[model samples]
Target: MPEPYEERTGRRQTGPFAGQTKSPTDRDGRAVTFEAGAKQPGYVPPLSDHLSPNQAHLGSTSAASQPSAEDYLQMGIDKHEKSQGDEELSESAHYFRKAAEGGSAAGCVFYGLALRHGWGVQRDEKQAFGWLEMGCATVMQKPSTDIVDLDRRQSLMPMGTQNKLSAEVIMAIYEVGNCFEHAWGVPGTKRNQPNHQMAAMYYRLGAEQGDRDNQEHLANLLSQGKYGLKKDMWEAAFWYRAAIDNGLSPIGLSWVYKVRLLANQIRAGWP
Candidate 1:
């Protein structure tokens, strides 16, 4: 009989790989001896290489998938309204700051409020004034010519132009007036001196823009003749009428009617 195969080959008789065949070629098919733990010559393409040009472009433009300024502002408002604790308020303020940075007027106003009141962030009245001023400028900086043009175009104007004065703009204007009236973030004495003239100016700005709330406040101020403003019953009646025309409810209407009647009487020399 022939010698045992394993003994002739000088190989182990048992154990792993003892009976395995060895190829003349290397592990990767090169005409060389196979070595343990050798580096492989494989390559992995980048993720972008696998995508089409259009897909790559879409991925590059992923910022378009992010929430818009208005979306962030709304989210902030929702969070603030529904918050039950300081942590939630902080989250709300964070979203408001993002929206403000992204150019939402309402976001600027609310961010200012947050800073002023320390609701979520530190109370920094000076910083709050800066944001409030920005919001005020955004609403009040529109050109008078734009208002005239919008009024003239009326039905022909684009929807955006027709609704240029959003609720946020109105609220910003009102808040700016409040800031002036109360000196909340203004530089002045520690006693918080009021800036009646500036308050009246902002209130007029909002009232002129068809904000019923501002119109009512302006009417009250004009009627009272306080806050450094001269008594002007005619102007007060005009604003009261405007407020009524802008959908004041029955309760509001009643108050406006009484004020308008009293203003008329005062103008007509009646006590």
Candidate 2:
């Protein structure tokens, strides 16, 4: 239960409406009283027998057929917060499925998690894998650089297929990778492989497409030979140099260059 506003604030809300009555109290530990049956505007409409058409329009799905992704996510969060019983958990799964079908990437991810854990859904690794795959692929198909301009000096991306990708989308790709690797909601499986390999792949794709963070991560991978990847000294040097030239980090690249030189010297002497 939340603390009543009156209890928290030293001042208390006195009466009902405008010009009806108003007063401020300095009193401590007094329960603030309100006029009985005072009505206010901005009522939160009940979850209608179904969602409104507007919500469906935003989601590209029929409101009657499914709750929007936002609503379902809220429902899941609410239930989780309340530590609800099994019944609520089941309801959460149902809503998550509806939202996922409506193309909510978040919904797909959560539903996949539920399927993996048998929480509010039957434990089904195959289904979970499919949902996880979809979520990852959705972002991969459209890199964030295609959506938004992160540099504040630059203008926003045009509102069409050519639009730049938003930072949100890039972050989502990273999160999806975390999900696959960490088994957050879904179980760790081949679909959700571990250790940054999948992350590296996605980051490389994003970097190649001009996402700054992806570019940086890809550079580090090349420079350090991450994930047991074969270290190509020249290729590594090239990427590090490219990143530095792109205004990423000159110092980091310099360090990598030094290491590359040392590695070459060792190789030349080995014969």
Candidate 3:
């Protein structure tokens, strides 16, 4: 005689898949056979008994039902800001990855941030640098149109679109400079740290493009003579003035005032 279900299967025969048997000759391979009147595991009760009409749409994957890239990005931001656990942070990172893959530079930067800090993903300096670089490259990769062609295209585009594009480009440039300045996602030891010369170069690039933050950063570096740059108070003052003109607030006010005072003294031959 066959053993009882508990003895043979090592489990109580009580659920939907219970009261089933396998062919003795091929017991290991054959599918289970349910006894007559036994409820199959795959059976589901009528939806009318459990789900309301409004809840019927709970599970869907329609094209129109999918979230847009911007929507994903906003969701990521919301989750990241309110995240109190690793799982929530990871979900935020997932949304950021989706947005980045959808070609959003801001998304790329945030994803890089997540990687760098290990907020929602593993800490990977190389990968973070790569994403940040890609974000900057995306902004700089405009079509090779001449100034006239560029102006013509810009004039044809809506004002909001043009402004949005410009903002993306500027933010990308500034962030790239920040990465270089702070050695973010770069590997180095105390004896051979991040190259300040490269940092200054990037800052100069952004500053020339009218980014006030980069202008202020470049001024700070020049004034300090750090990063292999020569000490040139005049040049530093020039950048400080440029930054001020571009709406960089009072951070450099003291430096500007002192530089102007020394300049006045030299001009009046007062040593």
Candidate with maximal TM-score: 1
On lDDT, the stronger of 1 and 3 is 1
Worst 10 residues of 2 by lDDT: 41-50
Query: Residue 51 in candidate 2 has what lDDT?
Result: 22
Model 3 clashing residue pairs (backbone): none
How many backbone overlaps does candidate 2 show? 10
lDDT by candidate, in order shown: 0.57, 0.47, 0.55
- Strongest candidate by lDDT: 1
Q: Estimate, for each residue in 1-271, the C-alpha lDDT of model 3 and write its tens digit.
A: 1222234545311112112232211111122455799545332112122112222332222244678666676777777656656677789889878877877666676677667556557766567766766666643443221335534543222334423334444444555555555556554423234444555555665667666666777777667665445666777787888878876566626667677888899999985
Measured with C-alpha atoms, the lDDT of residue 16 in candidate 2 is 21
The digit string of per-residue lDDT tens for model 2 on 41-92 reads 2111121111222222222333455466667666754553343345666776
Per-prediction TM-score to the true structure, in the order listed: 0.59, 0.42, 0.57
Q: Give a tens-digit lDDT track for model 1, residues 120-188.
A: 677777788778767756534432213245345422213454445655666667766666655666655
> What CA RMSD would candidate 1 show?
30.8
- Residue runs of model 2 more than 4 Å from their true location after superposition: 1-66, 122-126, 136-139, 142-162, 166-172, 179-197, 205-228, 231-271
